[model samples]
Target: MGRNTRKRRMPLATKVTAGAAALALGGGGLVWANFYASAHEDGGHNRTKSRGAQVATINCPDVGQKLTKVPRKARRGVAKELALLDRQITDAYTRLAETRQAQAGDANYVDNAILGPLKSKRTATLDRIGININRAGGTAPRDLGRFARCQGVPVDQPGDGDGGGQNQGGGQDDGSGQDNGGGQDNGGQAQNGPVADDFINIEDVQPNSRNLPNGLAANGDGGSTGSFTTECGTNENALRNSDNVIVAPGVSNGAQHQHDYVGNQANTAFASDEDLANGETTCRNQGDRSTYFWPVLRIQDGTQDIDQGRPGGGQDGNVGKIVAPTAAELRFVGNRTSDVVAMPRALRIITGDAKAFTNGLNNANTAWSCTGFEDRQVTDKYPICPEGSSVVRTSAFQSCWDGQNIDSANHRTHVDFVEADGTCSNGFQAIPQLQVRLVYDNIPAPRIENGQVVNPFAVDSFPEQLHKPITDHNDFINFFDEDLMNQMVECINSGQDCQ
Candidate 1:
């Protein structure tokens, strides 16, 4: 449960899109669709077409990202509305998956039955969001309806993360990259995706190809150079859930994917700060009560986990056997140019983009690699580790604090990655940079059978994100006691590797 593996580089990045619409393949086998629309009139790329103009999943804009400065009074309401938007997309995608045959014959079936209704729902949600902001004495976001319309983009290739990557392996057994139009995998299951292309042999990745994103690492001068390590048991008790208290505080199954928790015990979507503060923790140091969690990694071997029939599991397109990490190492390091300050209590930070597949790579920070070949990391593709090497996921969090609120309207502006010179910009202050390393030694290496990847491993994700590696993310909520917080800051600033 311990390692010297440093959380160094952020992963290489690529963007994919999610759309909503049932896609089907005839002839008793899965056929790949080629047309796709991943971007929107709002931003990114334009929609593409194919022989049949097929789309794989939903592609509505992420409203949460747009509301960077929601008034404090309206935050709770806006968060609920955003969660509703997510549910609308999930529902639309599920409906699309259930009606592929009708889509094949009626060109307008997706528009009439799914996209149109989805837009209407989104429009209402957006309007409510605007009302919340306006009533709270804040200016409402203009053109909120622009994000209402979603596309069923069918990108040009098979197994691409075009929201239609619902590729069935050659066994028509796996869905390829985002086909959003109606990608089907083995047994013709829709939205259960992450086709063969989502993976790559770790050896194929170029040596030293991965770089530290946004200059996250420090220059090691005039800064808190020490470290603090916490002995949090590796989710040994099997504490797992799909709720995200940071993003969707009161909504159940807001993530629509399972997550592995290693620290705090009372971390459900409904738990309030009071509950978390009083919650039992798994960390050896009772003072360090922070909650550390990430999407559960699963092996896709035609099996299912306990939550298979639950909302965040199979019902949300996550189908497989869950694998707990062998080690969950949480380390706190110092800034590159300054002494560190204490992270405010109840501080929440989310690293990486769970919707990178559809929201683009501007905020993406996913790092994937093998145990020994950690130097070469991949941001966009899942690494197929060698025989003895285990799968390693590393996430280096933002070390700069805004010096104000612990939470933000978007849950991001409160923290920022360091500038190129490793110094915080504006009035942002240096805080302990949390570097997390999670090791998976039990997951079997994926195999290629009949030109398809068999038993591939994937991270739990929102259904439309298509289980792409770029979408892997982590969440944290600091519940450390004041003495412990001060201790962490002192240990980090004093150049000591204390536990």
Candidate 2:
């Protein structure tokens, strides 16, 4: 079947990251509402113990997402600065998490000790980014420093926010992504995330709650209707790393999170285009050497992966036993309204935002569901599947190509989701959509009782993202040989399923 559409992007300042709502602990009557509150955008909101809450995280504008048009010559430098921006956020969050008591004791502590310094660092970074662009003969983004100031978000336990945090009997994310994506008053061990409120029982989610992503429709009106499947082993060799060749090509630990890999064996922070073209493949079809990967999902049961002490693992707030997906299905299907075109070799597509927890749902494409409840999926809350059912993560990549560049400054402008009516917009061409489905059978369902959670499963994420399901994402780079690319286009155009 043709793949369903998923995800998009937006401006950074207006977004509110996920966090538990402020709830007064009964009798004690004090809890911290840590997500960025709507009313506190101008300056950080400080709630005293008597006010029933305190701030929990620092929210900042995502500078990288705003640079959609950097010159190609300056992309590498801009990307590095963007990665540094991310690093600055991580450091500030580390401080925020470490100084909770200090935050409570002094109203100015967060703004002075954390957010203020963060703004200074960001200003310098943004200036460097602008310099990089200008030196490359491209106009630098204006007012880049305006995004520097960060806000301290507060969290509520259960019984906070709208709908009082999805019914505890089971939870519902609504998939609209309009509310605070499940709050986290108390972060998990290492103080990074996946608290009790992040999980919702699959049974409680209303069936078919997930709408068609961006209103993408199956082939209709001359659209290519066939499918192509690639047999890429599920990273059995444990090819995992914390670098993103597409986004942060030369920086080690660029992603600040570990990702499981399949398809291209030569993927790394330093892998050049030529290196990838000559790389070995894990796919059954040697003609297809595309790299496909996603964040490693880990079960927080006190065990740790090998990277537990490394940069992208325990050190970055991601802990737990790494759960390899039992099956990783990589499939490509035709567009919804036009005959598909062969994707240019080296085409890179990032379907979701790993920073969506703080960057907002505009680019959150991660879908969580159980095997039996395929019709019900969520963008924010993780699903607590019942026994006999396995967990599933699905990413449907962008299907429209700009027809000119293989990549863009921000890495997103080159491709886009189909319009609401199922057609590519702004002269973008329709290309085969890559859909990846990962299934895990060993993840034990988490138990939440009285607002406390037992073992929970979460995808590895940047330290500040809080490990929310919305931050889940996938990446792909096309390296198919010319003949194979042609065959794929032919197969889809001819309405024939091919392997």
Candidate 3:
């Protein structure tokens, strides 16, 4: 049969079920006759061709239901394996869909060549599941009808690049009395066509000069300076040009939605769990292979209409091309007296709850301020930049580690934030803290809808009901190498500013 017309057959399960039924109904003579016939007509030698035969209908027991009967001791392992297989199947389908979409003319060829191995692997996985179920004294499901079929569906489709803005060179004055240098105009908003003057000018946004509270600064007595610090990719320079700080290393524009990335260079949209575990990093110190990322903050120009249907932007009307901060504040904070150990590999951490943007700010660690106007600090709401000031976004992650688990059931229980005074709590060990600060230079003036001024910027996933601007939230993964982690420990314990 041709590739396009090929259909997967349920040969193995059907043959096995038939043989078992025959064995029960007749004697050894009938069993032998049936086996011989199957061997000649549809056996291992013709497996590939037979797969294109008609699918068989069988009632397989639900694997999930049978899993509950497994002994508690073996349940965890079985569940883990099942989950892994599930992910693999999903990934396979995603790959197949993308291949079909990209190679419509030759999709059948691609499917036969690429999907063939995937089907075999899936069959093997089903067999393994059966073994585990039988070993646990549970009734194994005979029907794998769901697993046998290929449901070609793309895992993620690229959203409309409608509001995407280009990086323009810095320091040009677009006649708005604001410095257009080192800033981006969403969809050519800076061009003096029919664009309105209500949009905020980058030159008008000044830096906050106030000496804000430095909660994340190291407080050690200068004597202990063994710990060193280094930066990864260029943050300030990239921000100046509106360039992407994070690139999806292996895939073409894999990030789908633009985001700022730190640490691992291999972090892309196609990065698998294992890839992240073993991926190389962009950090100056090769030992720090962890990754930090969050969506890019866009600058809104009131002239263009906002598409609430976009992926990253919530259902709110806030629109315009997002931009990165002018300056990124990087720091490590932890116990002032004790040395911090290297973070465990694959230690995922998140800070500044995104959902908290709508609710009141309960995260005491969340901080916000305006550039060139540091005296004005606000939490939960976007800092209203004065005529000569810009907005600064800041977030700090938990610094205390359980000293064992890299991750936990909740993705948070394994790690906890330092005490208000920067001390470890609940017997958790102190780890070098990670603090991120982002500064936004260009913020459009608040919009006037129905004669009322409303904020135009909102965080990536805020609720549609809440249209307020969100300034901060962060994510991190610790994949530090062993030697580098030891070096960090020595430096922090030795009390050296190893920057």
Candidate 4:
């Protein structure tokens, strides 16, 4: 929904490798292994046992040399580190390739399944891993390196808008003291370069959405939503800003109006033409990266207004929203903030209390809210569930669409449409028309003050905000912002699905 948040202070020379595998505690096994080999004296460090004997020398392919003149001990250590770094990079590269291939393998797989959301996750993981790899002294593939050079990719900061930041005009200081020069400074110019997304692995996902058939009407976009447009180009005019629209705790409002000006205007200030176009590429590419690991929005049910506690007719539809655990709330309730805390534990804390989510928006104390809409009647005299409210019969809708819960092994049992007239079926046009809200990595955050992206580490403000993002269409046109760098920063800070 916003800009990238993956940029860090690390230089291009110092890289770090991270992946979905890394997202798992086990993935960090390598990081620990490397640290162990580099740490403490006993078994951790310098041993006469010598991996040197195990270290095989190889000729440098690019610079045809035997490459064995360094100190034996140092050489061995470097080799070991290089080998580890190579494996990490190669593994990540393989995963990224597989993800991209899988994305193209089957349109249905990409659309109905996890392509959009997982792609974003994969991208983020890749970016992290790249950072790690660089840190570990690895270099980008020569081809990528050359591309960055030719394109003059900007340095990792503003003004260095080139591919690698060697093109800052005369290296003039802007007085902000920020190093904003490097590559071509297209600060105001339009850039039509190659699209770069976060690294993500397709094979490491848990299948979190309903993988329904593509032809279903419920899954198709209604013309009313309009054709998708990129953040770049003349097509950006179609973007819808979905900021601060609240979902009543228990009622399913039909898909709200996707107006051009409905979202927070503060974010719009950073709208540079290049940022818009490039940001579209970043958003769509990252969105695609996220789908392999998570679910993307296939269809958006139009919105309906809540009439008191009762749902309006034609508007009373079943709606679903992807709810994620906020990092802040977890920090408050959880004993430890380490990644060692399993997903189940995090899920427990996030969903364990409704008050945490509802009240998180405001500093003021609000009532604990647990109101989900269901298609059944309840007796008023019965004691109400405090965390959640009972569904009222009058509040139900007539036609409804439901998402396929691909995460569930028994997806066939629950993923289908229902008639509003109280009938169970899988076909479209069922009486209980349902509205499904696909969870994209797009988190709803206030706009950045200078149109610049926020630091990933600075999201401490609202840790309870869940970042499971979904992309209705993994096309650049669907993104709301411009500024690929900014978009990347946003994704990183919010910890949502991004590449």
| Candidate topping lDDT | 1
lDDT of 4 at 437: 18
Q: Which ten residues in a row have the lowest lDDT in candidate 4?
A: 345-354
- lDDT for each candidate structure: 0.74, 0.73, 0.42, 0.19
For model 1 the local lDDT of residue 427 reads: 86
Runs in model 3 with CA error above 4 Å? Answer: 1-228, 234-258, 268-270, 277-280, 302-310, 313-318, 357-360, 444-451, 465-471
lDDT of 3 by residue, 44-160 (tens): 111112222111111111133223244433444454444444334434433432343343445354346445555666667667766766786666556643453332211111112
Worst ten in a row by lDDT for model 3: 24-33
**In model 1, what is the error at residue 296, expressed in angstroms?**
0.5
Ranking by TM-score: 1, 2, 3, 4
Error at 410, model 4, angstroms: 25
Candidate 1 Cα lDDT to native = 0.74
lDDT string for model 2 (1-499, tens) is 0011223322112232344522222222234344422322222122212132455555677676667778889988888888898889899887776776776678787778887889999999899998999999999877877777776655443323443233332223345431222222332353656766677799998886656333233455467888889999989999998998988878899999899999999999999899999999999999999999899998877777787788988778887788789999988888767798889989988877776655545666658889989888776778899999999888788888989888776677788887756678788898988888889998889887445466878888887777777778899999999999999999988888899
lDDT of 1 by residue, 159-239 (tens): 344344443222233344433332335322334566555677999988876584434355265578898899998899999
Model 4 misplaced regions, further than 4 Å:
1-199, 202-210, 213-235, 238-416, 419-466, 470-499
Separate clash counts for every candidate: 52, 15, 31, 117
RMSD values for the candidates in order, in angstroms, are: 5.8, 6.4, 21.5, 27.7
Residue 124 CA displacement from its true place in model 2, Å: 1.1
TM-score per candidate, chains pooled: 0.87, 0.86, 0.50, 0.17
